[model samples]
Target: MRFFDRTCLSSLLGASLVAGSLAATPVLARQPDGPVDLTAQAQPAKPAPTKPAPATPAPKPSTPAPSAAAPSPLAVPSTSATPVVEEPDTLPVAHWTLADAQSLLATIRGIGAEGLFARDYEPANLAAAIKVGEGDALDQLASRLFVWLAEDLRDGRTPMTARVQWFAVDPDQDNHPNAQLLAQATETHDIKGVLAGLSPKHPDYALLKDMLSKTKDPKQIAMIRANMDRWRWLGQDLGLQYLIINVPEQELRLTVNNQIIRTYRAIVGKPGRTATPQLAEQVRNVVFNPTWTVPQSIVVGEGLGARLIGNPRQAAREGYVATKNADGTITVVQQPGENNALGRVKLDMPNEHAIYIHDTPSRQLFAQPQRALSHGCIRAERATELAMTMAILGADLPPETAVEYNLSGKYTKVPMTKPWAVYITYFTVARDVNGVMRSFADLYGRDPAVIASFAKPRELHTSQRKSNEAVIKLDNPL
Candidate 1:
């Protein structure tokens, strides 16, 4: 029975081999020499390959799709980190024509209402030029009109032709600015606006103009007129910050952008030969515990040399250092101390005249109403306060540094970070702290000349006006 079962199994295996060989024949024919294991499971037979159904033509649209490979039309460039540079301020331009000449003439005549000399603008000349109509005459007149407007707008008047002898620190009166003003006036047809823009912005000037327009008192009018002309002496713009000492008022005002920051009582030069000359200078440095090198005139005229000669020991005790020269001339110097003539501080403003602003040992002098007692240099009442204020405003000397040097009580000079511009001026009439116009004593007798200038016939040309200065040889010291 086992032999019969073995024979049947062999016959069944033979039949299975024949079927597997037939199934793998197509695959083996396509890939000859490929591995074919009989033990591996046979994969299901694939159907006969048929041609893919023809792809339906994509429905044609009105607008064709954009090509993905091409650059986009709305692309923006990457932003840069660099800052953009800005252009400088452009000057205003003028836009006046021949038709605007009459308006300009009317505006010119109204300058008198601004406390300015109207005739100086040559209104009659402008009128005549306008009457002549077209050509070079009208062109010249138009040119002159714009130029005058620009000049008056920037600097009240021509100081040189006005016969103002005092040094005018008017850096704003440069030709470039005048040219710009001319351009502006020619570009703008607003005659009244232009005229209004030209006047001094100071409250005092406006106040004087108001008083002159209404007041009838001759003396009062004359005083106001003289003061008006005095405004012409200074630059149109004083500065963002400056020190102005009114000699007649005996007051020193620290002004920033025309507004008074602080007012200080001051002791100015006496009248006549010792009068403080009106000047514009820069405060270069502040010296603490300053020494006084006595002027020759003071040493000899005050009999200080004689005292030193008679009692050298006494002179030494009083801080005087006397040196008798080979020529028998005496040089005197006071050492830095509390009793020094310059007191505890001195502001150095180097000028040809050797002028300075300093402190004084005599604080009582400030209490007096008329405080004109110095030789030439201004004596500030609260000098230490002034020094501290300057140190703060300029930031040249730190508070600690100022305090250290001030308390040290030693002769030391501290240069200003930014030199403060100082104007030692003499104005008999000016506005007070309350904005009320006040008249001061004409300590230097200088009002007559300034006042006389108003009465003098207006010269045809500014150059024709003579210098009012009278050169006099005097025995008195400067």
Candidate 2:
């Protein structure tokens, strides 16, 4: 068995390993400890109180004059009689000609090439409608089927419920509205071309589709189909330049113009609750020689606060500054130094979860093949190099200036001139750093849910964008 398989088996057999002990007290930092308890049972310390800001006064409402327009309870409202106007971009179903309907039928038959089921679009009903000729019956059914097909292609066949910990909001629905697509298809009479355009713009989507065509094994086909839909879960176009971290593979790809420019080994969150949630955020700034703020879980719960409160010498030696707040609460901040937990740099991407990519003092951890070790945040290997590259590319900082900042050993945050995107994604199967197509162990076991979703009939899209799971803000890089 592989290392990941052995580790996963051991974790399963030992419940304590899979889920940290709830009764165990928090411990102070030495080197990085085992996975931190991030479940709801682990209560975080209450934040210190601050004075409330002054509220703005509400304006008084204007009184309306008494009118003699009171209607009886049985009376129909005048506005209810008005005809509903279709949006300017909405193509009338009655306007769809036989040629256009036939073209859509042809596209529906071959949607399986794009990893979609032809039966899901009600192809037989569409064919019957087409046979009857263009009328209300034909128009309504054709239009409805077209819209459904368009939605599945643009958004995804899988519903939100099956996407475990998915938080990336797809903007394609708004950018290419159903009505607008229908209008364009009918106007140009290029139903196949218009529908094909809805596929994800990412190169991986095309690769997956090509693979699906050549593969014959049932399991491989299902896996390819599941991953193909996974691409649809994200935005159609991941920006021109961005950082995409695949959590399962424990690798980060720096992509430029749909091409992989660089790859870095990464240490992702451990299994269970500390497993990193999927996210798409902007890298606003890169901080060099970053400080680490010790959470109260460590400072107070673990007795680190009491130990360092009066021992300035010990605290200085550890590169930490401990202060007792006015509220009798203890605050601990690790200063910038060689001993700092965040080694030398961190990419500041603001999000609800407080997850970010940063350097680690324990670089040896990256040498391990199965690197599901961090609390939740990502630890990038050779992170200083990654940081300096980001500084030059995203912030337009000169190489010498970046070098100076790194050597200065002071916390310096350089803002990006044009913010680049950072996508924290989970893929069980994808191209590895060496550009070889392979499968990684599902460390978090998220693949089953997606694969199961593919077995059922397609579900309707919902308003929910991200996972409804509570955002656990344990920012401990350890």
Candidate 3:
């Protein structure tokens, strides 16, 4: 199977703009309701080194090896010829460290999110999104967006101990970004110069809200503030199509172009023992007729009873096939088929947590608002269709190949030709679902700090707001 990835975001900070007095100018940039301050240092993009491709010429055909001296007597035969340096594995790669991801997140000190928010693109966020085609840069960009779409509660299920998702946009390129960027760019460029110009009074939303209120380094703050603007101000207003879950509300929503398409009840993981960790990754593929592997924790713990009672026939009953390893340790694996615990499909978003999104036979659980009952993974309602949608993201996929799993047990590999992104987001502001504003049980308890950020007293606009962070309040408390 071939795999690739991409994001829907691009840089949005335009040339310096003036405050106020706006005329419909190039890419109408909307005036920010208030000043955007910068306290934390900006995260500068570092150029990555590229590996030069080897210049080896094609090898000429060789005569067959002699019988006695063939390779080696005890040498293990390579399972694969010209073995790839990267071992064949089922795990997803996580390149960003936790700290690297946290820098993009926001704190309660401000109203704006720290990383790229939908508001940045203003009038053009959606338009600009369209400009980003199926390129490698776009995939990296989308991966970054994944960080914002999904949250990592540090629950045992997912490996993102620090990174988190905040929004629920579509997992497809159905929406455009270039258009959105144009709309926002027009809004800001029209008011160049008069605007407060990213200052302490502006209170840059990156780092914590009080970053400027605490630090007093202008040079440090200036550069940091600049990137912060680019990151925060410019965003896809008609956000990407994604699956958003509000941890604070215990809700799940699928969105398309800012409009929510579906809402469902979800159970989050309990805090500590298996906190629902904030994570950002894409659903690369979906597994059909999936089987549940009782985690080691379960196998070694309470599940042993069920394993003993169920292990013998667990393969057939649970729709799995059992096999003992050379070490005599029994293992049960499930293949794609009806009656499979995974329902019909499962999304593959590799993270430290073996957590994944899959169809759940237990549809009733979705009705419950506090649905954090799984070991750590998410049991999605209508997950089979969701998988189908992922397959559809791969435009080249023959419609039959995309849905073939429903017809048979064959594993389907659909490469994203147009680039589809899946985000397990977590934003609790509500409004997107178009349903009555609902709150959720904080099963993972991610709100206290974020909620506290709102309640924390303010510090008078401090020189520190400029760049260097010392952790002080900005603006005198009311």
Candidate 4:
């Protein structure tokens, strides 16, 4: 299969693009009240250090800190000062000992176990530099190679061009800075251990690695490798509690302490322009008995507004409130009711995509095997239960209060005392809800680019953390 169009490949092979620096802005925490404001929040600036902090040894991968606050929006720059190096000379060289150089060469040579090619790091060149007996040449070559390997392990091996519609900003680099890792590796001479620490902390990566070792078929190995790399694209530690939705699997999982607490069937965006984009967002509020403001595309283009304006009785019966403006435009809102587009609850996670998870009035849609049915947003099955659970877990709301809010048939927004991370991910090869390893159909045909990237030489990591595609706000649940 053709992985990329000519235009896309041309852009990928062209000069690396430098991402502009983002000015940090303060974000004010909002109280749970009316509808959620989906504005993007900037990451606050960190204070400069007066002296270099002691380099702490890398810790073993454990459950992520439960109380850590959600990260800033995808557009927000990483707090880590790790430079995106386009060339070997771009990075600062660190003094390398002969022993450390030997260890690094061995680590690079055996990188294939992590689905990375050692040749990409120029292992031969590093070995030759080591033969010349530890000098600036050896230090410079080893440092550059180490940075490249660390970047691939921490961020991902796939270039931005191959990752279609992906907006999830990985925070691994911030957690494990490349320069810091390089220094730590040289100081401790534990080259392998330091680099190995960069692997994604998620269990799925380990499982995929195991599968890769056992699988004999070339195709299956490629699939496993691609999925393994997908894990690296996300944050190393995916918090103590989070919600993960696998779009192709049509599954939503509520995981706590690396175990699945609950699973919900999900109806994701339809394939094509409305196909759901991968995202990493935080659920800030839970809206019970939510209202739906009809978009102009539906109100005008679909003639719903004109019809509602002409038939007031019908509009009222359908739970629609219509108003005619002086500008000859009509406004339409589907009031909170059983027939409302957003069934009983909505998880408010503000981002530029305007995508949210909400209850669906059409419960039968969940039963269909092919659930790529919505415009863009996720239509969750048993949404009231999900919302109640989120309210109790995130907002510390009493179960009774949550039920009351759901049954009250009135709008209520419960702000999260502790916002939970919500990941809308697309994985063609992954464990099903029942914990069975299997492959789902690539509903959006996204796997080819990633699989193809694995076959080609590794590309330099760029400043771009996400796809540069224009943000398409598809709010309509239908």
lDDT against the true structure, per candidate, is: 0.60, 0.74, 0.36, 0.75
Candidate 1 residue-wise lDDT, 1-478, digit = tens? 0111333323422332223221111111111111222112212332121222222222112211111111212222323232232222322334346667787777766666655444555566666666767565555545554555555555544333333335544454553364565655556756566556755666667766666766555565666667776675566556667889988888887776666655778888776666676677888888888888787777898888878966878988999888898999898888887788888888888776667888888888888877878776788867876776576456455555666777776899877888588888766677654444567777777666555545542222122222345432221112
Q: How accurate is candidate 1 locally (lDDT)?
A: 0.60
Return whichever of 1 and 2 wins on TM-score: 2
Which residues of candidate 3, in runs, are more than 4 Å off? 1-239, 300-318, 410-413, 435-441, 454-478
Q: Residues 204-280, candidate 2: write the lDDT tens digits.
A: 78877877766655566667778888898888999888999999888887776777655788999989888998999
Per-residue lDDT value at 55 in model 1:
23
Superposition-based RMSD of candidate 3 using all C-alpha atoms, in angstroms? 23.0
Give the backbone clash total of model 4: 0
lDDT winner, 1 or 4: 4
How many Å off is the CA of 273 in candidate 3? 2.5
Candidate 4 clashing pairs, residues 3+ apart or interchain:
none
**TM-score of every model?**
0.70, 0.80, 0.45, 0.81
Collision pairs in model 2:
none
Higher TM-score: candidate 2 or 3? 2
Give the count of colliding residue pairs in each prediction. Answer: 9, 0, 110, 0
Q: Say which prediction, candidate 1 or candidate 2, comes out ahead on lDDT.
A: 2
Give me the displacement of residue 25 in model 4, in angstroms. Answer: 40
